[model samples]
Target: MFSTREQKLLRYLMQTEKEMTGLELAGHLHITSRTIRSMIKNLTAILEEHGAEIIARHRKGYQLHIHDHSAFRSFLKIVAFERVNEQWIPSDPSDRIAFLIKRLLLSEDYIKLEMLADELYVSSSTVKNSLKEVRELLTKYELVVDSRPNYGLKVVGNELKMRFCIAEYVFNSAQKTTELVADPEMAAIRSIILKQTKRAGIQLSDIGLSNLVIHIAIACKRVLLHNYVSMLDEEIKNFEEQAEYLVSRQIVTDIEKSFNVTFPNSEVAYVTLHLLGTKMVSYRKASDALSPVNLVSEEILTLTANLIDQVENELQLGIHDDQELINGLGMHLKPAINRHYYGMNIRNPLLAEIKQKYPLAFDAGVVMSNALHDSLGVHINEDEIGYLALHIEAAMERKRLKPKTKRCVIVCATGVASSQLLYYKLKSAFESHLDIAGTMNLYELRNYPLESLDFIISTIPIYDDLSIPVVEVNTLLGNQDILHIEAYMVDHITLVLDYTDPELMYFQKDLQTREEVFDFFEAELTKLGRIPAGFKEAVIEREKVSPTCYGNLVAIPHPMRPLTKETFWSVLTLKKPIAWGDEMVQYICLLSVQKEYEDEMQKIYQFLVKVIETKALVDQLIKIERYADFEQVIKRMEEYGSR
Candidate 1:
C-alpha cells in the first residue's frame, strides 16, 4: 500500500498538474521551490534511468514524457520461478517433486498436505511442486526435508532456523505483485515515494521495497529478540551489532529497495531508540520470573500477523483510532508473554494522550499500523518498542526547539479592562506552567508574526491571522467559562513542554471534536432525527438581528454560537455574485464564534483574506471532475488554518 507521504504527494500532483508550474508545484508539494527544482532534475534523471526522458520548458517545469513507458511496463510482468518456494502454490508441475520437501519444511507437528493445499488455493500437485522448491531452498542451511505418511511432511533441522528460511521465501513470493497500478492516485504516490528515495540518492526499487520493510522489520524484531536473547556471548554481540548496523547506516535503503518506499534514517534510528525505551519501561524493575526463548520464527513473524486479523470478525471493531486499539495489543504476540503480563496497560496513558492531542498523527499512525496488520502480520503495536519510538519520534520533531518557553499574545478591545483581565488570568493560568513567549494588545494583532505567539486569548474582536491556535473567550471572564478554561488548561499541560507533544490533550479528544461546525449539524440534526440544536438557532438569531447580509449577497450565519475557542468556515457559490437586496456579494463567508470579540472576528476576517489571496486556486475547484478531488480542496482549505 502507498504510504501517507507518497499518497499525499500523488493527490497533490493529481490536483495541480493542470498548470504544473514550478511555483505551483512547490506550493502543492509543501516543499521549497529549490526542492521542487531539484526534484524535477532528479525526476528527469530517474526517467533517464529507465531510458525515458522527462520533458521540461522554461516556465512549464517538468513532465514525465515517456520515451518508452511500455518497456518499463513489460519489466513488471512476473517471471515464473522454476523452484518456487513451498509456501508458494505454483501453477504447474515443473518442480512437483519439490512439493513434499516444501511441505516438510512448513508443517509444524503434522504435514497436513491436504489442508495446506486447500489453504494455498492450489491442487495437491501444485502444492507438491512448491514443497519441492521449499526443500531445495532450505537445503543450503543444512536442512533436510522428510515426511511421515501419518503426520504429513516435516523439516528436520534447527526448526526455528528453517522456519526463518521458509518465511523469507513466502514474503518475497507474496510481494511479487507489488508494482504500481495505472490509477493516477497510485501512480502519483508511487512516483513521489520512488522519487524521494532516488533524490536522497537511495536505491529504492532495485534493492526492493519489501526488503526495506524487512530491514526495518528486522530492526524492530531485533529489539524484540533482545529481550529474549539466550545465546552465548558471541551471539549476543552479533545481535547487538546487527541492531546497531541499521542505526549507524543512517538509512534503511536496503530495506527501502525491498519496499520501494523511503523511510528516513532518523525515523528508523528513533524506532531503535524508542524500542529500547519501551523495553526499559515494560520491565520497570527487572523480574526474576524468566520466560524461555519463545523463538520468533520468521514464519510466525510473517504469518501470525494474518491469523489475528480474525479480530475484525471476532471483535467486530472497525478501525477509528488505531493507537487506542493498539494500547492493549501486547497480549497478542506468541513469544513475548511478558508483554501480555506487563506491557499494555502501563503505556496506555501515553497512547491515550497521543491519540487525543495529536489527532492527525494519532489517526495516521493508527491507519498505517492497522493497514500493515491487515496485510502482513506486522503487529507494530505488539512491538511496545514502536510505542516508545513514536514518543521519541514526536520528541524529535523540532531541531534545537526552544525549551518550554511561553509566547502569549493577549488581546481585548479595550486593553485596560478586559484585555488586562485576560492577560493576568492567562498569566495566572500559564505562568508557572509554560515559558511565557510574549503578550499583545488588540491594536498590535496586525503586526505580530502569528508563529511568535504561543497562545491568543482575546476579548471583543481582532483581525490579524496570528498563525497560532487562537482561543476566543468573553470579556467578563465569568466563573463557568473560567472553569471551562481551567479544564482546558489542565488537559493540555503537556503541550507547554512540546507544542506537538501527543499527550497534550490526554483523553479529551471526544469532547473537542464536537466543537467542529460540521459535527454540530451531524450530531444534532442527522443522528437524532431531531431539530438541530446550535446551527438553526444561530441562523434564526442572525436573521433577527437585521440579517447579517453584507450588501454583496455576502452574509455570516451563526447561532449565539456559544462561546468556543474554535472557529469553523464553510462556502457556497452563486451562479453570479448576486446582490443581497441592494448589495452585491460575489462571495460570502460565515463564522461561528465563542463571543462577539474583536480577536475572534479578526480571525474570521483573516481566513477570508487568505481565501481571497488564493482566489485563483478556489476558482479551479469548479473544474475538478471527481468528488475525491473536491473533498481534497476542502481538506486543503482546512490546512490553511494550520499554517
Candidate 2:
C-alpha cells in the first residue's frame, strides 16, 4: 500500500489536468522539493505496474499518464477498500484537525501536544499549527481548548455543545455510518427511527434521517461513558407537552429494549428536540397552500410574507407571488426556527454548490435572512440560508419554464387606422413573444397604465422620460424596428458593457490582501466621488455574512446594501493570488449598484456569475495587461450570455 503522502499526491494529480512542478507539489504538501522528488520517484515505480506513470517534463512539471483504464480502475478500488479497512492516519492539515478533534473529544484527560505529534507522525510545531484551526472550529460550537501548565489541552464547553461537536467531527468523519459503529448496530438504529417516524406520520429528509441516526448513536455512546444531556425542569415540561415528545419516547423505548440500555428523561427530551428540528411537512393542498399548519404559527407566516415581499421588492425576481415558494419557505422556517431556538446546527452539504451555481437565488436568500433577522432577531446561518436559496431557485426555475411574454403598448401619432395596422404587424411578427396591452394615439398614451407595461413601441418619437423602455419604430414596422423590439422580448443582454467602466479597470495590481484591495478601491473611488463614506465597512459587513469568493480564482466584493448612486463594476486583477476568505482570488470585481437600479441587480449578477463559472475566462482576464483585452473578454462573455 502507498503511504498517506503518496496517496494524497496521487489524488491531487488526478483532480487537476495541468502538470504540477515539484515546487508547487512541495508547497501543497508542506514539504521540501527534494522530498517531493523522492516521493515522485517512488510513486512512479509503484504506478508503472498499476497502469499509471508520472512523466516529468524538463521545466514544466510532472503529469500523470494513465494508459490502462481497466487496470487503473481495479487498482483504485483495491486501494480505496484497503484504506477503508485499515486504520486511518492523518495525511494533511485538514485530516489532522479532524483527528485531533476526535482525540480531544474522546479523551477524558488532557493530552500533550508532543503525544499528538507522535500519533500524527509529525513534529510538535506542526501539531501546534493544526491546533489553531482546531481551536477555530471548536469555537463555532462554543467549545474552547483549555491549556494547563502540566496538563496539555482539553475541550471544555456545555455538555450539549460538546456532544454536537463530537457528532459532527467524530461520527461524521467517516464516509459510511457503519464505519463508525457496527454495521448491524447502525442498521438497527436506523430501522427503529424510520419505523417510529413512519408510524407517527412524521417526515424526515435523507440528510435529516442520517443526522437523527448519528445523534442517537452518539447519545448511546455518551450514555455508555456516563455522560447525559441536561435540561431545565421547565424545558423538559414544555417538551413533554409536544407531540414529538411522545414519538421520542416511543423511539427511546424501542432502542432501550434493543440495546439493553435505558435513556433518562433529559436524553428523551434531547431526542424530541432533534425530532422537532428535523420535522418536515408531508402534504399541502394547492388551494390553501399558504394556510398555516399546526407547527406554522401566525408569526412564521408573517415573517415568510415579509421575506417574500422583501425579495420581490428588492430583486423583482417575479417569485414573490409563487404560492409554492410561500408554502415551502413557511414550512421550512418552522423547524428552522426550532433548531435556532435550541442552538442546533443543521449541516447543509449543498451550500457550496448552491453558492456557486445559484448565486442570484443565494443572494435573495441572504436578503431573506436579513429580513428575518430584523423581524425575529434571529441570525440565520449559511447552512439555513442555503436551504432557503434552494426553494427560491426552484421558484426561479418555475418562472423560467413558463413563457415570458413581454407586455407593451403601441403608441402612434397617426389615426386609429395606422395605429391598428402597426399593432397587427407587431402581433403577426411576435404573437407568442409579445403581449400587446392596447393600441392608442399619442394623446391617449398619457392615460395608459405604464406600470403594467414592460416597454412602449411608438411610431412617433415620444421624448417624455418614462419608467419602462421605449422602442421607436416606423409606422410600417421595418425589419430594424422588429429587431429593436425583439431585443426587449428576448432574454438578450442590453449592453452589459454599460455596467463596466474603463477608468475603474485595474490590471496586474500588487495588492497582497483583502484589506489592501479594499483600501485601493476606496482611494480610487473616493477620488472619483463614486462611493459613499462607509462603502468599505458595508462591504466588510457583507463579507461577514458570507465570503464573496465563488471559486475559479474570482471574488466579487460589494456592500451589504446599495450605497452608490450609480451602478458600475470596479475590476482589479492581481499579479498573484491573495487569500479571500477560504479561497484564493486573483480577479476582483467590486460591485456598487444604485438603489434605483436594484431591479437590474439580477442581470448584473448573471454577468458576474459567468465570469466566476468560466475558468478559462478568469485565467485569460487575470493575465491581460490592457483594458482593451479585458473589454473584449467582457464582450465575449456578453455574447455568450445572449445565446
**For every model shown, what is its TM-score relative to the native structure?**
0.27, 0.83
lDDT of 1: 0.41
Q: Which ten residues in a row have the lowest lDDT in candidate 1?
A: 499-508
Model 1 CA deviation exceeding 4 Å by range: 1-125, 136-407, 413-418, 428-439, 465-472, 479-643
lDDT of 1 by residue, 1-643 (tens): 1122232343455344344666555444434456566655644554465545556677756554445767644522222232122233433343234334444543446667787677556678767656766667667565766667867766676532443444344333323322112234334434543444443333222223333333334333333333121235553444345333343233345435544555443334433332222221122112322222122334433433343243232222232223323332322232223223222111232543332233222323333345445564444441233343253234324311423444456666665665667667666755665534445666677776766555666665555554566667777776664555444342231221221121111111112111242344435333533334456655554344233333212334445333333334434333333334223333333344433233233334434434445546545543444435545665577655545
Clashing pairs in 2: none
Instruction: Give me the displacement of residue 228 in model 2, in angstroms.
Output: 1.0
Cα RMSDs, all models: 25.4, 5.0
Identify the leading candidate in terms of TM-score.
2
